[model samples]
Target: MTSGPQHPTPDTHACSAHPADPSMAPAPDAERCAHGQAFEILSTCHEHIGERLGALEEVGRALRDAPELEQQHLATLGEVLAFLDTAIPIHSADEEQSLFPRLRALPTFAGAVGDTPMDCMEAEHIEHGDEKARLKAAIVTRDAGAVGRHAIALANAYRSHIAKEEEVLYPMARQLLTDPAAIADMTEEMRARRREAGLLKC
Candidate 1:
């Protein structure tokens, strides 16, 4: 029962190795029992996201206080961007490609969560990309005002977004993903997704 870090590093490994491509066929029950592990992976990802959001807010404050973007501020912003640019897609695939689809397929599951919540989550995922682009552009251009504006918005949006998943979606997953084969396949797909993204080694 290894666990992920409470606060991940700048270069957190996004992928996890699995027995095989769970997408191809359901693995044996003995090998497919990682539902709790899957939840832990997502929990670790959120912890990293929350920490980075705080850092982004601090970057916003620096931009607001200074007349011009300092070199240090730029460097910090670049690191934040790099982390999110890599991490967000990997996280999204964990949800959209693996988690959400699994939850959606369970007939009993929808009554508890409904379609709207999942739909909203997907929409926010897209908005995250848009906000990240805006922030990147603002940082590249050294437009402190735009950077600050988008940073605050992105942080706020994610805060709300993550809250919903933590409160509703993940709990639902824990209850429903008890089947050994399903859990194995879902967890394997999660690893495969990050591997495809070149996240590498976990």
Candidate 2:
């Protein structure tokens, strides 16, 4: 495991004044992963995810109270939605594509029984996706109750999922994945993903 900043600096200006339209609101700070530190990057991503989940929960509470999307709530919703759409997928890819497969190939994990930790994490990822879809649909239909319910559900699920990864999965990976070449490859792949998404300079 590598040591670095655990959380990105939030762009306070983005939400300084609520926009008239939620879609017009600026996005949250873009989380950046340091080169050649794949596990650190993943951990940083978890921090960002936690922040977004907090924002989502706040949105849920606001909606529950008013049952109408206020400007501030919409601004927060936009940030949360954008994170779900973009950052979450990339983070998932970092785990599923880069880290999980490497761990699975290791002898310690190769002979594991049915439904490994990786399986559970992937399954939870799918569940989170489903919940996000429901939340988005509710937002589109202006269903305040449904939006609040789904947002809170998604936030809770993601928080638990993050905990499992941080506590069990990440430490396991750090212990097992000690190959320098493998770490380099994972770092390159992650950087490539960001470059392709136009989030990183080549």
Candidate 3:
């Protein structure tokens, strides 16, 4: 290890203002595998999702506080909507095809996986889709009150959903899946899916 101010002692403890999922990381050598790199992509998306949620919350607060929002505030809303439109299907597709299948294959997590965080998250995603549609409608109508209420609800919903994914789902997926070969296959699947969805570069 290079000795510098950058390297903290092993025993050093620091407070983190943000919630992070350590499970999303792979072992040092495992990073050579495409699945490990895919996790990195997913982690980036997680951060992106968090940012959009914050923007939505801020816009909702503005809408509720005042009837007339500045063009900048509306621009923020537009950005949030664009992010959601791009992220929701892709993120969910990855989970549905890759993570959930591997999770279901694990006997240890059978009932717990079905009933605990996955169940909660799936329900929230459905509700989130509905809320997003409503928000778009509200935006079209220029209904500030509708937009405000939907934004508040969506913010709360996303916060809960992301928390469960971070705290429970990602950890369980990491613990259950250990076959390097299988993860490699999953990574290829993610890549292919991305290409099919026009989410990947040629």
Candidate 4:
């Protein structure tokens, strides 16, 4: 029998061309049969989020070091704003459009009605988007109040964003992605979008 690990596969595909996760523990047979793809995707998402959080931390440090805005600090602020503007939206959209819909399809997320992860995530995107705009303007206009407010907005949002995604969204998405068809669709959708956005190769 071809074991999962030893299963025949293509040479050019990613390590996940079959199914695997670096962060999650090995799934038991039943759970593996159900949520394997979700587990892998969740692991990758967490890594993505963690990396972004680290960059955001630098923004916080800059703010702390220079309580009074300085022109030199605009460079750091520019990096933070640009990252938030680009990266967060794509990640959030992947979860909302590709991942969360699959979750909401499952009976496990029936109670998730009205407050699906996608809906919550979309709201936060809009909220953070406003903060990003303010942060950019703070740099351009040299407005201390705007800088403080934008930094505070991102710091506050990161607190809740990481918590909710880790505690709520990851598990839920994992549960829903059990369906092979669902995972396959999500993989294709994400790959296409990423390629279009120049975030990935075809």
| Tens-digit per-residue lDDT, 35-70, candidate 1 | 336776676677667777888888887677567778
lDDT of 1: 0.68
Candidate 3 per-residue lDDT, tens place, 11-49, comes to 111111135532232223322323445555455556567
1 against 3, candidate with superior lDDT = 1
lDDT (10s digit) by residue, model 4, range 1-202: 6744322221211111223222223223332212334345444544554555555555656665465777566666666566556656666667777876776666555665765556666677678677767667776776666676677667566546655665556655554455578778876676566557775311
Better of 1 and 2 by lDDT: 2
Among these predicted structures, which one has the highest lDDT?
2
Show where candidate 4 strays beyond 4 Å.
1-46, 64-68, 108-113
In Å, residue 158's CA in model 3 sits off its true spot by 1.0
Each model's total of backbone clashes: 0, 0, 0, 0
The model with the greater lDDT, 1 or 4, is: 1
What's the lDDT for candidate 4? 0.56
Error of 3 at 162 (Å): 0.8
Determine which window of 10 residues in candidate 4 has minimal summed lDDT.
Answer: 7-16
TM per prediction = 0.74, 0.80, 0.74, 0.66
Residue 159 accuracy (lDDT) in model 4:
48
Order of quality (TM-score): 2, 1, 3, 4
Q: lDDT scores for all predictions? A: 0.68, 0.74, 0.65, 0.56
TM-score-superior candidate, 2 or 4: 2
For candidate 2, lDDT tens digit of each residue in 1-202?
8985333221222112233322111223444464537887777777767777878988898778676766787788888888778888898999999998887776565566444678778878999999999998988888888888888998877877776677667776777777799998998898888888876311
